[model samples]
Target: MTMTVVPAPAETGHSVAPPGRNRRVRQHWGATPYLFLLPALTLLGVFFVWPAVTAVQLAFYDYRVVSPAEFVGLGNFSHMLGDDRFYTALTNSGLFLIGMLPILVVIPLLLAVLVNLPLRGIKVFRLVYYLPVVTSMVAVAIAWNYVYHQRGILNWLLNTLGLLDQPVQYLLDPGWALPALVLVESWKSLGYYMMIYLAGLQSVPRELYEAAAVDGAGPWRRLSSITVPMLRPYIAVVMVLAALDSMQVFTSVFVMTQGGPQDGTLTLGYYIYDAAFRHFNMGYASAMGLVLWAILVVFSLVSYRLTRGKAAAR
Candidate 1:
């Protein structure tokens, strides 16, 4: 005699997922992040992308806010060749680019090195240095206005130190106005770039410096051989940022100088603002904006290449 077995029946209320159900669930989860990003993308398109497109279109028109836009093709761009103020603005921007490089790049590196040392109260010093970076540019400009005054703290210190025999007005004088703005801009930006360099410094291996010291390397020698080489990538970043910031110098010129004293401090950014708002030359201003944008693109590309080449060489 033989015994036979029987199969068990399916569960009463349990449902089985259909084929590809797990894949469908995974696809739904993959789309979840894009749903979260939708709000930010919408705002960016509405605010930035739309305005940029409008500006580019306006660059080809002759629109004065009160008048209807007339298609002018490249007329607005051509007009820039005959505009003295345009050239002046370009010159001022060039000066800012030159003036900010050393101050923003070298000084910030030095400050980062100093702050990175294992000294007591170093964190306090770092906080003090970085305070200006978080402060509003408007407030910084207002505060510096006093420092740049004819009889202000800067003049008094210079006088006491015998550096100046008489108080000279900085923002009032056409010759000194642009330079004064450069100083203020550089000062405000230094702390920001310093923190960047500080981050890079902290990432560097401490063993290299220790080994160099064991071999009797001095501070300057160690910095030149080890620290500088290590911080090169950071320097490239700072250089790009500084170049972009310098070319777009505006707030200080607006608040402190108003691009005044015979347009001495008239940077491309300030001029663009003036043409659009003050003079109501929206089309011309938009054209200038496009030109400035092109310049920035080219400048950034060149700078990045140079820095990358140097880093590779080293």
Candidate 2:
């Protein structure tokens, strides 16, 4: 017996939909993921967006905790122009950025190179270098306080080496206070930047170094030509991060000098804190905060552009 196969009836110029089409459509445009994201979005708006709006609004008003807010409309910003302390803070913050750049950007690269060596137990060295990053800033300040003491080991060594006529109080000296805090901040953060560079270093091709070596390139030559070029992106990241950290140096200053020794260690971050909490000038503090934010944003953009332009040129 022969069986004949027949085709099913077809619609006129229209295809029939599969039973699973609606299910697939629902899955493609599902609202479940968005529903899950709503909580985090709500929290972000409450914590970050709300506070940012409040700060901008408060910058236009004079609000001491004891008095009702009076709309001053750029008065706080205008006051910043004539404020000597504001200028001092800005100058000190700039010095910090300068002092920290080498420590964070250059030294860390060397450190990453050292730790990237294939020696036995090299991981131990990396961990040792990174320990300070996880340490509490307050604790580091306290320990550094001992080190900066007149009779401390550092002073003793300095005296032994004839670097100073007598023991000097580092934190209490106007000339040394900012530099001392800079050292503390750099020491604390060096490990973080080193780790960043280490990651970049690891990603670099070993074959490049081998090729350079075959061409009779020395260690320094290979580093300058290969490692540095390859690490440019990481260096850019480090520069921006270091600039931000240096500008906002507050904890060490607060714990060690309290922006004192004749305000030598005064920084934008410290000044903002003092204006907000100590002096209760909330509007002025907010204005200064905005200024600091603007400076950081501009600096970051410029640095990023320069780095990217250099990379592209190469």
TM-score of 1: 0.92
* lDDT by candidate, in order shown: 0.93, 0.92
- In candidate 2, residue 286 scores what lDDT? 94
Residue 4, candidate 2: how far off, in angstroms?
7.1
Q: Please tell me which predicted candidate would have the highest TM-score against the true structure.
A: 1
Best by lDDT: 1
| Cα RMSD (angstroms) for every candidate in the order listed | 2.8, 3.8
lDDT of 1 by residue, 5-95 (tens): 6544454455667769988999999999999999999999999999999999999999999999999999999999999999999998999
Residue 276's lDDT within candidate 2 is 98
CA deviation > 4 Å runs, candidate 2: 1-29, 303-314
After TM-score superposition, what is the CA distance of residue 97 in candidate 2 from its true location, in Å?
0.7
